[model samples]
Target: MRAKAVRMYGTRDLRLEEFELPEIRDDEILAKIYSDSICMSTYKLVEQGKKHKRAPQNMDTHPVIVGHEFAGVIVKVGKKWQDQFQPGMRFAQQPALNYKGSLASPGYSYEWYGGDTTYCIFPHETMELGALMPFDGDSFYKASLGEPMSCCIGGYHAMYHTNKQNYDHEMGTKRGGNILIAGGCGPMGLGSVSYGLVCDYHPRRIVVTDVDDAKIERAKEVVSPEYAAEHGVELIYANTAKMDDPRQGLMDLTQGHGYDDVFVMVPIPSVCQLAGSVLAFDGCLNFFSGPTDKNFSASMNMYDLHYTSTHLMGTTGGNNDDLIEANQLAASGRLDPSVMITHVGGIDSIAETTLNLPKIKGGKKLAYTQFDMPMTAIEDFAKLGKSDPFFAKLDQCCRDHKGLWNPEAERMLFEHKGVKVEV
Candidate 1:
């Protein structure tokens, strides 16, 4: 079948093109992608193309599709998995298919298996490794957001605190413990806050620090302090960018006791240092950022590491179980990952939106593969609605739901007059 896809040709080079897909093998599955969440990792991959661990070297010759956090319906089922996954069933993708410990993942490694496309094939390896999850969520956006949510869940699960007496490591964040998310208020950080609020491991206090006050305000508005109180969690959004001593100010939030779990959300040396310096005894630090640089390093308090039993670890993506939990939480309405979406676009916007992702403000830039709309911020919907009836309806849907992108808005997007997109 022929499909339109955003293909990465080289570093900083992406193009939207229509191409024919080879017939699926007996063990592979074919799917039609609907919604794909633009990720920072895709930005890094595009910036470092061949040098990226997951990017193939010969991109000029064999361009790979450029997305991962995506969801849609199954179009064709392979012979082997007919009983498990049927055509017309909804599904979400876990891109980190660590098959045989290879760095190759979907969105970064595949030619026709990524999410930024109208149609793609799921390799037999995907089925064998269980990276393709079948979900019946309310909207495709929720399933797309699940992939990023699972990343946060993995970081949460990887958090470990050591026993002072036995020196044993306990997995998962400490219940009723102080948690800090450094460089938070971004997309993944918002996911962290959402998961922390809903997860069984209740944090006594969750402090989020970001450089941008606007982003902090937006985070507070979406995941409000009032909502946190309802969940028996103290949520605080702090602007540490202007602070002379960020570590001290962050520690002061915990009453100088420091935090039990510190999550580094951004790939900056200063944030890493800040996250490390404010850890309490037996504190677990999970570096959640994936930097493009090979030798990225940051100074840390070694005394705390050696004597204070401070644990440090990093997770790139989540496992199948983590994805399952994210889907379950989202499906049950305990977690609303839509707060991460700030912009909406179509297949035409993938290349430009992805290339300038860092410069673009706000959270996840979601794209519908079959649409032909420009990248427009959700916040701009009301302003755009003044002239266009389409934006007016979408804006109303968002306003009805506390200015959030919901399933109703997603349905309205497709039903909008004269906005039909075709490849």
Candidate 2:
């Protein structure tokens, strides 16, 4: 089958090209991608290319596809997996296939298997390892956000508290304790806050800090104070840039007990350091950011680390279990992953949008893989309304959600744009 995909050939060489796919083996399944949420990690992969550890050494022989956070429909089920998954079934996956400790994954390591493409291949290991997940969600984009949401979930799970006496470490943060999310206005940071509020993470108090006041305001809107109060969570948003002493402000919120769990979202050494300094007794600091620097290091107070039982931990990608949990939470209306998305476009916009993701602020940039549309921010719908009728309806939908993208907006977008939804 011939398909179009954004492929990484070398460092800083991501090209949207047409390519032919090989016949699906009896042990493989073929799927048609519907939606993919562009992640910052994808930007990293695009810049690093062959230099990326998971990427093949020789791009001349092994070009790779460029997305992982995606949802699709099974177009052709393999004979061997006929009883398990059928054609037309909706599917998503945990692309972190840490198979026997191998560094390879679908979006980064495979040539014909990735989310950016119109079609993708699911190998036997993908199904055997149970990474391929079938979801019953209202929006394909919401299902696609599951991968990134699972990554946030995995970070919470990976945090461990140390026993000062025996030095034994226990996984997970303190239940019903205070948690601080540094740079909480970003997409992944918002995901962490949403999961903490909805899931069993049981955060009694959650403090979200960001340097950008506008982002903090939007974050507040996404996870409102009323919603947090209903869940018995004291949610606080702080513009750290305005504070003379950010640490003092955070301490005052926690009554000097400090945060029990600190999630560092920004990939800056200084932000990681700041997050570490605000840890309480037996606190676990989660380094959730992926740094581009190979030798990234942050100064830590070793004395406080040993006496206060504060430790730091990090994880790259989530396992299959996390993906399942994320999908279930989103599908059951427990987790609204749509809050993390700010812009919507089609496959045509992926290349430019991905290349300039850091510059494009607000939240996750979503792509309709089958459609041919320009990148459109929810905020721009009002301006676009005067020119296009479809955008006029989209502007109203955005207004209905207080300038946010909702399932209703996604459905209306397809309807007005004359795009068919494959069930």
Candidate 3:
């Protein structure tokens, strides 16, 4: 069998090519991918080329598929997996495979499997041990959101400093009493917003700060005003590029005490420093975005941390259990992950679409296994210079409904138009 895939030949060099599919081993299951979302790190790896240790090491590389977040249906299963996963069963998989003696799974490493292809072969360990989640929902796109949502779960876990006996026992809230999400316009940031709303701690207020005006506007447009009003969540749109003291604005927002939980979704060193500056007593700052270079460092007051009891931790990827919980969250209808999807295209556009990740805004970029839409087509829809019919309708919907959409209505629209309403 032949399948379409995006092969990373080297840094900044990716090609859409056809590759022979490996025969399903007795312990392997074959999946037909329906939707895969472009990750920020995928863009980073493509641009960084050989500098990315996670990329294949040589030209003889196996033309590894380059995606981690996706949802698919079981197309074929080996004898061993036949009893478990049947053909046509919809599912989402955590692409991390841990063949190493260590328990940790192979996430973006050379030994791991990726989802940015038309089909994939996954091992029994991944399929049976909760790495692959069965989709009970109507849309594959919503299931595709599991990977990022799991990462958000990991970030929240990292942000909680359980060692603080007093706060953990008395206040019952994790490390930071209140949570602050910086650079909240991105998909990861939005994931944080969704998770924050449902977290056990239930911070007094969830503050989302962003630099992009358009994204800020969109955030306000997508996040339900009723949810915000009920949860006491506030969206702060600030110009970080021109601000002399971004920390000052954060401090002011927090009533000068600072936030108990802060997730720095942006990799900028300044954003890290700003997170550190706005931490409340015994607060924990989780660097949600992995720094691109080892040289990247942020400054903070050691005295403040020692006296105020603050912690700084960072995490990457997520465990299989996290993905299961993420899928459950989305399927519950409490959170609409589809609203986060902004672009959709096929493997042919992966190269150029990934190259422009830094410039793309608003929501997640989805790569479809069946569509042939080009990068330009999506850009044209987004760049109608504010006159785009979609944007106009979206704005009207937001205005009339106060930034929330009826998922059922949206589903009807997509289904009526045969637009593949996943999520």
Ranking by lDDT: 1, 2, 3
Q: How many backbone clashes are present in model 1?
A: 0
Residue 113's C-alpha lDDT in candidate 1? 91
lDDT of 2 by residue, 173-230 (tens): 6788899989888989899888888777687998999888788888888888888899
Predicted candidate 1 versus true structure: per-residue lDDT over 128-246, tens digit per residue: 99888888678999999999999999999989887857957788999999999988898899999999998889999999998888888899999999999999999999999777888
Q: Rate the local accuracy (lDDT) of all candidates.
A: 0.90, 0.86, 0.69
Give the poorly placed runs of model 3, Cα more than 4 Å off. Answer: 59-61, 101-113, 162-176, 232-245, 376-423
- How does model 3 fare in lDDT? 0.69
Q: Ten consecutive residues with minimal summed lDDT in candidate 2?
A: 414-423
Best by lDDT: 1
lDDT of 2 at 378: 80
- Candidate 2, TM-score vs. the true structure? 0.97
- lDDT tens digits, residue span 83-167, model 3: 7778888898776555454332322443224567777777667766667768887667778788888888877765555455555
Please give each candidate's TM-score: 0.97, 0.97, 0.84
Q: Give the TM-score of candidate 1.
A: 0.97
